[model samples]
Target: MDAVIIQILNGLDKGGAYALIALGLTLIFGTLGVVNFAHGALFMLGAFVAVSVNGLLSLESVTLDPTKLTPWGTPAEIRTKLAEEWFGTFGTTLIDYSVPVSIVVAIPVMLLIGLIMERGLIQFFYKRPHADQILVTFGLAIVLQEIVKAIFGANSISQSAPASLAGTIDVISGVAYPTWRMVYFFFSLTVIGAVIAFLQFTTFGMVVRAGMADRETVGLLGINIERRFTIVFGLAAIIAGMAGAMYTPILSPDYHLGMDFLVLSFVVVVVGGMGSIPGAVAAGFILGILQSFAAMEAVKQYFPGIDQIIIYLVAIVILLVRPRGLMGRKGVMET
Candidate 1:
């Protein structure tokens, strides 16, 4: 029982990320009618944000070799000055702060990146076929991944929480667990909550939601639907970026982390319904919990392969019964 409880808690963290990414995908599909294959790249960009923030936060004094430290070839003075300025100005606390601190920087950066992407690239693809969109976005995903690898390198970068967040704590007597994962789980939930609240209550979200229902109709009301969509794209990017930013400590920041979640995010989007916010949230948790539970030794004993595909297996079953999705409309795709 205790083990099952642990897995359930674990699954929620995974599910939270899925829900966030899927929500972004759904927003684009629901509004723009463009099947964005590059959505994963946005997820990747989000993770990369963590890498960037980590780099900045972990700025260190350059170890200059006497051979290169000379004025002729080396900028040793500049490097020394840089390290001191960064640590002194930013405070050395960031040196030991958890990776999740990147969320602060990731949000605005992602939003700006999203806006640029939508206006600069995706806007042109809006009228193209899903195939073209996918091809372009697929290529774009590769390009984005390569860029991340080039900058951050293929090796994963790790960050640890502050000393305050380190070590295990007693959830129960003799049952202490790692503290960072718990912190990540909570941080992710908070992001999800804020996003949901914005979508549920904000005026901009209301407009975006209306556009998602029917852009042509929304346009008829004199709203510049395209501008709203650009913002929505950015919002989605923010969500994914924030997810990746906070996720740095758990899995570390790898160039490939975005691709890892892409397919599952798509599955979550489909399983949740075409444009149903509640459904997306629900499906994310459902799949997350099931996958976590299936990872247990007991479930594996009964169904050997369930551990490998329990989440996807459930997705297939849901699609089989509800071709439109659990809460998807009959023709939301057409609209």
Candidate 2:
């Protein structure tokens, strides 16, 4: 039915986000062999970057004159009257232009942050034990969240899509679908495609893949495997951050969004398997669609608390049956 189709579309977008985050997680786990618990924080940082970009763009000055004449050389009195009626110096002057411009600004800023975190923090833990690595990255995640809070304040930052994307579109004769949500879906798909292409065809990706297979031999051959791992971590952070940035319109940026996403992302990664890109992508969509099915108004009425249990229930069943996950490698977690 129309309702079912609609929910499936809705779930795809959420799945796209999950796929993106999980893909990054799988890449790091497969290549660097490090269980990064800080990935959620990176996602949080991305959303904050969008917020920061929006805030920065708000600093622009319109430089309007209350008494200035118009293109038709309208009377100063009329112009002044209009300005007095509709304008204020204290409030936002560029509210219309801020969101679109913020997206452009958030990317580079977040990429730089990603590089810094990888080079400075995550790199050190690459050689450490899983427990130490987990603690360090978890601590780093906390630190990152605190830093975001300190800068953006403890409260969530308000942001939404541009005016052009604020409303809904009529997909059929009777239904009007939300434009921002559609845009989010498209944006996430674009990112996921680019990432998949990078992993599938790029030389750098090939090298990383090589390293993932046998890092010891790759290092013995004189390649800087550690440096590649650092880059991988940074790349992972950038992916999470971009996802966060684009998600601002869907969910406002909060200090805890990182942790929020981190948990679901981990589930996504695990359900996909330890290091399978296809698995991550597939599981993300599967879980997303399943979530949608569970949230159905009719289904919820019958299942009672279906939304709360659907994901966990599905995960448990998958792990019980697949053990290593749908596409998981036999030796992945065992070693």
Candidate 3:
């Protein structure tokens, strides 16, 4: 029972990332009718944003300390973070919470990137074939990955949660959970809810949702549906970026981090149904939990590496059973 609880929590934690990424993917697909292969790269870029901010905060100011002499040197050099030197205790605390604080930087950066991507590249592919869109976007993803590798190198960069949230939390009598994981899970849920509410309740969301249903009709009504869709694309990028930024502490990020989640996110989108937000979220959590269970020693003892293949296996089986997807509309991919 305790083990089951543990796996469930782990699954939710993992699922939060999957759902967030897939949500953004679905939004782009639904709004602009574009399959964005570069979405994962956006996620990677978000993580790097956190990395960049942390790096900036930790910039060292070195000064010679005559009071502390080295064994063979005239004096020792004292190095301190510029943030610490500038703000003292407040700066130290800010640096300590850099990972979380990075969101502020990430939002604007991602929004700008998304806007440039849509206005510059993706807008041209709107009327192109899906294959072309996929090829171009995949190429873009590779290009982005290589650019990051060149800038940050091809190694995993470690990020730590704040000291206060680094410890384990006692959830149940026998089951303990990581504090950061819980924070991440709740944070993800809140973001998801906020997005849903924005789409469902607001006037702009209504127009966007209507455009998703029928862009031609919405445009015929003089709504400037294309511009709204562009905004949607940017919004989607922000969601993906924010997810990646928050996830750095959970998974040390590397250049290939985006690619690592790309396939799974696609699988989640397909299983949830192309353009189906709720479906994407639901499938993400389901697959995440199933994958978690498959990783158990008892299960793997019989199946052998089921954890790695469970998601794909499930995808195959589900597609066979339901061609469109679990919640896909009748004509989504039929054309």
What are the lDDT figures for the candidates, one per model? 0.78, 0.79, 0.93
* Cα TM-score per model: 0.88, 0.86, 0.99
- Candidate 1, 183-211: lDDT as tens digits: 76677678778877887899888888888
CA deviation > 4 Å runs, candidate 2: 60-97
Candidate 3, position 303, lDDT: 99
Per-residue lDDT of model 3, residues 1-335, tens digit only: 89998888999878999999999999999999999999999999999999999999999999999999999978998999999999999999999999999999999999999999999999999999999999999999999999999999989999999999999999998688999999989988998999999999999999999988888899899889888888999999999999999999999999999998999999999998988899999998898888899999989999998998999999998888987787887677578
Candidate 3 lDDT (Cα, whole model)? 0.93
List model 2 lDDT by residue over 1-335, tens digit each.
78977888778878878888898899889987888899998888888877876665455434455578777776444222222235553234345545555557666776687678777776777778888888988999999899988888888777877777788898776677888778777877787788778867998777788887788888898888877777777777777777778778778788998888888888888888888888998898889888988998899999999988787788888889988987998788675
Query: What lDDT score is found at residue 150 in candidate 2?
Result: 88
> Which of 2 and 3 is ahead in lDDT?
3
- Cα deviation at 220, candidate 1, in Å, is 0.8
lDDT of 2: 0.79
Question: If the candidates were sorted by their TM-score against the true structure, best first, what order would they fall in?
Answer: 3, 1, 2
TM-score of 2: 0.86
Clash number for each model? 0, 0, 0
